[model samples]
Target: MNEQHPPGPAEAPGFWLDTPEHRQWLMSEAERQWTFFAASLRDGPGFFSLDTAGNPLSDDTQELHSTTRLIHAFALGQISGHAGADRIVEHGMAYLRDHHHDAEHGGYLWALRGDAIVDDRKLAYGHVFVLLAGASAKMAGHPDADALITDVSDILDKHYWEEDAGLFADEWNRDWTPFSTYRGMNANMHAVEALLTAYEATGQDVFLSRAGRILEFFTARIAPAENWRLPEHYSQDWEIDRSYAGNPMFRPAGTTPGHSFELGRLLLQFWDLSGRQDRNMPVTARHLIERALKDAWCAHGGLAYTLEFGGKVSASTRFWWPVTEAIGAVAALIKLDRQASDEQWYRKLWTFADTHFIDHIRGGWFPEIDNAGQVTSTIFKGKPDIYHSVQACLFPLTNGLSGHIDDLKHSEPVAMR
Candidate 1:
């Protein structure tokens, strides 16, 4: 079904997220999540575990991705002047330096169970987040920020980057000897995000150049060729892998509409950061956002998890992340075009989120929901992390996309409670 907004009154001069009421609400919500996550911290190694109801679960293995994400989130908290945020950021940084990093292997191991390597593979997905965490930490004035950023950047350049391909390889063994031939847009998409943050943090030309190349490959070339239903899996040579489905949660089969929304917003950020030279960037971003909404929005309400390349729904399950990404995508589009339909989408998506995904009493978003908008645990359970939802609240309030949250100048003040 085609989703379009009916003609309505012109939206006010500024974005909704910049308004005092929304800013206050977003900050309050972010603080609530921060308090929830801060409660899960374990002291010895300073790592968090999988959590349910603001408490860590029985899983002892600390995931690199979630740990890095929490660090990044807390770093944002530091930027906002939230009390106790620095301690959380420092705790996460210590975990990354002392626990996650492989000094001999030259990159981070994927997961750890109490100093024993649970999964030692070096994944591009995990490493990109390391870059992001470093950037955020640096922005928040962490003492070891420069070292973390430099180490991750050098490691990425040395191990993962294919200088000729302008894209990253997927994974490698712990000692960095054997490499996986598999390639993926998911990793590269996140690489662009990290690269942009790196460039902003260090003012490096190479990071920006690499980001542009990746955007050109995925947003300019492949996405348009595939009619904006981006293919996720790829071969070593970057050929589409239609039948390969590796992990149900991370590397699922078919196109992820959530990713399309995320790429849409990232492309716009790149366009602005690159001085708006590439006219196709915003155009491609709009196409991606519109196509994702049209193809993936479940008739019952929220977005479906996955869709075939031909625009058919492959997984009808609705998850919280996609909707949050959609909110950011539409917000970016609204800033560019200020179309009434986009504004309608922005408001509509937040309404859907508040009605379904948010946990009013528990204080965090439900990670997964069914098509009927009922909470579900089929794919994820109990608020794994707060990265996506917090960003959805934060990004729209920024004055520009040049840097991390710490670099963003608040467009409006938080309303007095």
Candidate 2:
């Protein structure tokens, strides 16, 4: 007689994804997010941040991440065959190419106020998103995709990449002067994401090789020594910078578990793309993912913002992006293998999101809420981002655990999501 394993959630009788009700609900949420964000384009080809009432805020300053994220979001809409996705893609691409692109400096500018350049720093954090927008638009079949991809790829190779360190340098002044000796894992984490997306788009081994180097540096080498809670800051010599702290929201003092979740998911994607070459990788990814969930998941049914390097809660405030990123990470684990714990965490995080984060009327997630479940915004305000929450809903619907969303439109379609 064969020993039996208990049924995971996906293996249960009514746990089918192809069911009309399930598919419709998932796709509808994804579409709702897309439709809600389309309002940002009301001012034509520039950026518009939205307030809680779904009204565009007074700020006209556009950051590279914000613009590129919108282009990436709508590119997913086009990838999923959502109607009118092309309009937003075209709009965002035009703004990105025209205003954000530095004609004098060659790399994208850091920020813009209307047509004027404000803060022309060439940051790797921002440039990776440009590459992401390019890869996403390329996958979506946008006309300007190739040009964006080629330009950004060349910039990254020429300016950002460090061959000996096997990682990208952080920032530079407008005319390519050295801005700082600072290095960061946040930007490099997202670099893996954009590089993987580029590899998927162009089948370029160079992208894959560079992404692997970053992964190996952080995950395979650094993470194990740090007890799987990756550090956020680093010196020019790549030493851990525990004393460094800037931007409470972005570059917090201690390690960020949210980034661990993201890096874990990216590792899985890297493993998949490499045809599962290394047997040790999945274990490494799992350590990163589960360690984050264990360290950050609070009693309030949400995750804390950041944790100390020793696994203590450094910042107690909860934010929306961490939960969304964790959801994406868990969704990937479930896709890779429907392990019982992964399935349970998947359901648990979605429950928390539905209970606290999502705004049923407005269609996008509320940025933050207190432990009592009352809406709060001490740090984050408005519904400015369409990238994180939307992908949390969209990733589970895809067959592959990687960032690719084309599966929703092609390859053994379950529903036209």
Candidate 3:
């Protein structure tokens, strides 16, 4: 007979993620991931590989979004007193400034292959991450962060922000001559995250105002009108394009349940940041979270990647990022209401993640898993970076979504050692 291991302390009664031991465990796991990525860093102009395990695939192309996320994550590590965190942050910052920056163009390029520009399109999604990285680095006391933040903000305002539409344009050519007619909620959602951080880092009201505008449009108007099933793609005129389907990975067809969960969390964060003035925000957030959970949560385990607007599963495959976002969504609801149902959903999501996504031997999450709870990499392979998983661990441990994790004063002392 096999000997059984006792349930861990995290499974104990009332031992939510905010508990001291759990928070410490999250910090330790974050450090583990940081170390893994740090060891894989490619020097010479400073960039990171796409995957961390087994020969490091996609070592030639460096994605600007991934680079910025790594910078932001490592900056958090730096603030937490991790030893090599600052070095990684510095390396990523140098890469962003020297390599990713388009000298002839106003904005950063999409990706780089060695010294050559590969995908030079200017994307709102990538640009928002640039803002986020700069803000996080600034919070972590990086020397060049202020200048980076200023430059990225200027660029966003000049190219991405649509003053007339009160939203952001999706993409543009390298020279900013040809702008895509496509408008997307994904990029705008990330823009909300970046703008919130920018406001926190600089205390600028303009950033906050812009963030509020995006939130109001999506949460207050669009989500409510659509029965909380937010559309992902839109035309240049901001009309929903039901027929538009781009990349299966990034621009999947149909409504993304993951985005609903993410937008729910961001709405709550924005509401909290705005002094809780918007009474409708918490209500809207709850609806979005519940809609996704009802429609996307796989009957067997995990969540479906995409769903039809009427709550039918579009993509039956499960990915790690959606589950992480669902964890965050329920965590935010728990913070807002402390309802027993919210707590139950939170525990359920964590259980799903631990069972399917977590790689017990490898020390990081698997990026994708099938509905049967078996590991699969049809879309994403080899633990693409720790940004989503680390944040899934960190966000629940915090009191509110204000500023960067480094700047917030946790209710329990963060185990930084």
The TM-scores, one per candidate, come to 0.93, 0.94, 0.93
lDDT, candidate 3, 236-319, per-residue tens? 889989898999988988899899998899888888888988788888899999998998887798888887777799999888
Number of clashes recorded per candidate: 0, 0, 0
Candidate 3: C-alpha RMSD to true structure equals 2.8
Candidate 1, residues 1-417: lDDT per residue as tens digits?
Answer: 212222122354556655665556666666666767777578777565545577777677788998899899888888877678888899889989998999886889899887788899999999999999998888889999999999999999998999898999889999887677999999999999888888877888998899889988988889889998899999989999999897887999989999999888888888888899878778899999999999998877899888988999998888889999998888788767878788778877887887788776667788887656678798665678789988887777665554546444332323212
Best by lDDT: 2
RMSD after Cα superposition, model 2? 5.4
Pairs clashing in candidate 2? none
In order of lDDT, best first, we have 2, 1, 3
- Candidate 2 error regions (>4 Å): 1-20, 411-417
The TM-score obtained by model 2 is 0.94
Better of 2 and 3 by lDDT: 2
TM-score of model 1 (CA atoms): 0.93
Regions of candidate 3 where Cα sits further than 4 Å from its true position: 1-11, 50-55, 404-417
Off-target runs (Cα >4 Å) in candidate 1 are 1-15, 404-417
Model 3 steric clash pairs = none
